[model samples]
Target chain A: MKRRLFICSFAMATQLFFAATLVLQPARAGSEDAKSSPTEVRVDNFTFSPETLTVPVNNAVTWVNKDDVPHVIASNDGLFKSKALDTDDKYSYTFTKAGSYSYYCSVHPKMVGKIVVQ
Target chain B: MAKNDRFDPSLSGFIEHDHNNDGIDRRGFLKCMAWAGTGALCVIEGGILKSYALGSQKGSAIRSHKTASFSFVQISDSHMGFNKPANPDVIATLKAAVDKINALPDQPDFILHTGDVSHLSKPSEFENVDQILKATNKEIFFVPGEHDVLNDDGAMFRERYGKNSKGQGWYSLDKNGVHFIGLVNVMNLKAGGLGTLGQEQLAWLEDDVRHLTSSTPIVVFAHIPLWTVYPQWGWGTDDSTQALSYLKRFGSVTVLNGHIHQSMQKVEGNITFHTAFSTAFPQPTPGAPEGPGPMKAPAEQLRSVLGITHVNYVQGRHALAVVDSSLV
Candidate 1:
């Protein structure tokens, strides 16, 4: 009986060890995603909310149009460009390098925004 | 100023027809609007606004080309740096328009470039337009298009050409007993919506025309159509009705616009709305294809589709003879 009890405890210990390993593996990935998850820039009221955003290099930034009109996103340095984004439309671009990128709505020139990837 | 005497078809009989006929869907109405590309010339006669196609000869009762007191040329949507399949050589076309204006039988007193002076809003693009338009040598007045205000909120445009403008590049001037109002409506465009004049600009416009005599002839020019042309493509203005309310008391009012890349005209009460063709490229007629954008016709037909407008205002008669001739 004692031998059987010892075997059961050993099995339990192995199972717990494997479960802990499985949990830790995803935990690391989850933290990485938290860093790289796309940051959002809302286009509303003819202005970009949080006109300036900072993200890690290679992170993705998504611009979602919340206004009723259409807007196009084009970077000043000609790094990224988007089609006419109508209401609720979204455009995302991932920065491969770190630098300051200025963008404006091609439809509404005065509506400008900036993004810093570091 | 009674509604019954108003010249707007919508206020007269068209609105009634629109409601009574269930078969005329929105698409059908848009199909009618497509013919607006033919160009509508709004003429004020006997204190009533009337619009007819520029080439139509049916209006013999009101036809009077006897004399024109003064004339001006309107060139719009030059899009200087635009290089696309639709129009690869925007500069050539703009130069052609300038040549046409220069060769007019009578040199236009001045030139009114409605908007879209540049495509990418680059300094070099504006410079290209400046060099080309210098050939005309006529006093030029400009209002900002959405494209012109792109990078610096029109600070560069204001610095370069809009020095005399009021807030956001809107202003008024008097020329030969006529009041010309240059309005900026493309500043804060609504999403998937038409242009907005904003409350501030509207208030200023109200005050600007408040003290003017009812007999004063008014000419209001902007980038977008003051009337609702096509809401689906943001072709019209949002608060234009309010802005226009101030001018209804005037005996003659002519509103000129550009941005649809095609010509269209409408007459409502004392207001005569006329849109001009772009010097860069032609856009699809409203509801012609899927939507409004750069439309490439046969390469040979490009010049025929693009053109400039010559407007002649008679002093006492209040008759405006608008001639739209192609660059070809």
Candidate 2:
């Protein structure tokens, strides 16, 4: 079991290393207005836009609530959770490890999303 | 709108939408009301269902007053502090609800706020609701909606609402020979989005009703609908079946819930599940194109879509008669 876990981490580490190079690059001029990275998720109309997101290890991602109702983001595992994000409120999390993550709005579980930390 | 369309809130003067109790029977009456868009007061006298539309009743549920031994109002999803296009001034609408409750023939024994007393779980939100609900001058009981427990895992909600309750605020009360069990199912929600009444609460539920006789009438109030209204929308509870199994021996079980933000009713054998409307806003029906959220009803019809439920318990009756009254 330990060996298998190690093998999985090694694979993820390689993917994370490659992923880092993609996001670690500096943004071209005027590119800030048009995000070059998938670092933000918007909660609107009881849904997470870009239902799936991928980022490199240690990359920070933020979720902003644009809807009038409040929403809570909670990871499937006992990992990260957010306080209720009311309209125009935001919560951010930085992934430090490489793996697949699943989350949903605790207030409305039907609104689900995923984050792939490579 | 069609002339006879039942949803017209403009209708006036005590209209009994369906008075042919002889043909419909209780089962058929429920089947019809389950699809009814307007509010109704259904009185079960001697196992027959007699219903009156609230659009004309003004608030009194007058027909059932004679047979009802006691009545309590159920209001859900007040969503205090909700300032969306749906219903900009939730306070005004909630005050309207208080007015409707106060207008009833005999003041309901108490009020059951099924859940969502606050929109954002903020202290101020709860306080605003407290101030508005105080006008009824009736004691209010609560179960927290998922929205209520969002911040601090419901620390603020339990502190303000369920001080003497147990385990994330689940408790049971006995009043006038009727048993009321308040359950909490919004804490520690599981992934894939479904309501959960964890093992601990289920165990407590089993032990809670152990002593009641089979003749007892049980009313279960919670934030989420226990029956599977639409699992795709996370409208149902994961472990509610087990919690309900504990109450199977009882003659009648009525489950009142909120969070769907629309009125819906379902009957399954001995159990009847009814969901109340939000005093603040309406929501889409199950399986709508956009998904469920604070639905924006046209301003004029907003009050008609939002409503409260009145449940009357007649001594020795097979079931409690439920009356849903709109804020208008």
Candidate 3:
């Protein structure tokens, strides 16, 4: 009778352990994704801070203008265009497919930045 | 003419013209005006500039001046999208300019906006300027300012205004016996560099003007000053010398510009270089303590410093008579 009780308790504990693992796995994976995606570039002093950025597919990248004057981020291939971003203005675009994108400021053409998506 | 010169100083001003073949006579008049005052109207006749200040002894002498063949208004640096404290309401100021143009005693044949029609190259901003300018009932010509070409290499601006223009939006039009060349120099800027007319545009310009007679009056308008107005602020054009070389043969070459946001005039040989005031905001003088940007002054005085230019092309004048007036 005691042996039967021990077996039954062990089975219940095993099932509970499996249930816990099943619930925790996706949460762990989701946090990892949130950590991996880097999605921002800063504009200040007439330049993009991370002139080159890398991101995952379907991730969005935001460009925030911190300069006193105005700026614009335009893709070379006519993919994306931002309006004149005055101070504190922000522009964002999502990378749906994996590719490389190059852009420059329309005001200051010398100011350029690149993005690579994997 | 000699008998009348002894009694009237204003008549003596005309005597100076007889000696203008030497080019020293105009310089002497400029020196006299500098010592007298800056508020004076100067008329160029047969290559001589005669000054007549308002209420001066010679002011009425200019009233009998011959009628102009045609006249046009020059509005620059409207900067419609700018919402900063320096000039929060650019649209209002631009409207005032249009009102000023509409109220002119003689309606202009057309209007030439030197550049900077928008502050941020926003499509909405362009549309706003178009809407306001439409109220003037005058045809408008546009060249891209650096600000106008900020997005997609000015793809939006070119689409709207440069549809009939060549690459980078440089084109020429012949109107009423006058040849007007609109140039693009604000594109492809270097680091804090001066404006440039690339080799492509320069070649095109040479070919464009090749067939025209030297007697044809050429009006070249661009965003930045073709001359080195103030290189320290990147206010000059790099390849303008080459562009001006193509125009040297012309009897009257008027190069009008508008980046400085203030009125400044210079005459070199047959070329008359004039920079107009902005309709948006005034920038600091080139050598002021602060570098170039929107400058803040007394709020009420802003409009008094920002305005448009009126140019009259008299039939026999050496060049256009440029008059700059503040909105106030």
Predicted structure with the largest TM-score when compared to the true one = 2
The full ranking of all candidates by TM-score, starting with the best, is: 2, 3, 1
Q: Score the docking of each candidate (DockQ).
A: 0.06, 0.57, 0.14
Report the error of model 3 at residue B262, Å.
Answer: 1.0
Candidate 2, residues B1-328: lDDT per residue as tens digits? Answer: 1011123333312335444445322444343333234557665443344566655563344544576678899999998878877778999999999998999876799999999898878899899999889999999999999878876888888899899898999999988888999999998887775888898888889998999998888899999999888898788998888888898777778889998877776655567778887899877767776566666666777887788898878776655878777777
- Predicted chain B of candidate 3, TM-score versus the true chain B: 0.86
Candidate 2 regions exceeding 4 Å error are: A1-38, B1-38, B44-62
User: Which run of 10 residues does model 2 chain B get worst, by summed lDDT?
Assistant: B1-10
lDDT of 3 by residue, B107-209 (tens): 7799999888988788899999999999988889999898887757778888999899999999999887899999999987654457988999999999999
lDDT of each residue in A1-118, candidate 3, tens digit only: 9996675565455434433332211111112343366467888655688999998755557788765568767777766767667777776665555889888775665577899988
Question: Relative to the true structure, how large is the alpha-carbon lDDT of every model?
Answer: 0.72, 0.76, 0.72
Alpha carbon lDDT of residue B251, candidate 2?
Answer: 74
Mark the regions of model 1 whose C-alpha exceeds 4 Å error after superposition: A1-59, A62-71, A74-118, B1-42, B47-66
Worst window of 10 by summed lDDT in candidate 1 chain B: B11-20
Cα lDDT of candidate 1 equals 0.72
lDDT agreement of model 3 with the native:
0.72
What lDDT tens digits, residue by residue, belong to model 1 across residues B105-160?
75789999999998867899999999999999999999888878765778999999
Q: List candidate 3 stretches off by more than 4 Å.
A: A1-68, A72-84, A90-118, B1-42, B45-66
How high is each candidate's TM-score?
0.69, 0.83, 0.71
TM-scores of chain A in all candidate models: 0.70, 0.68, 0.68
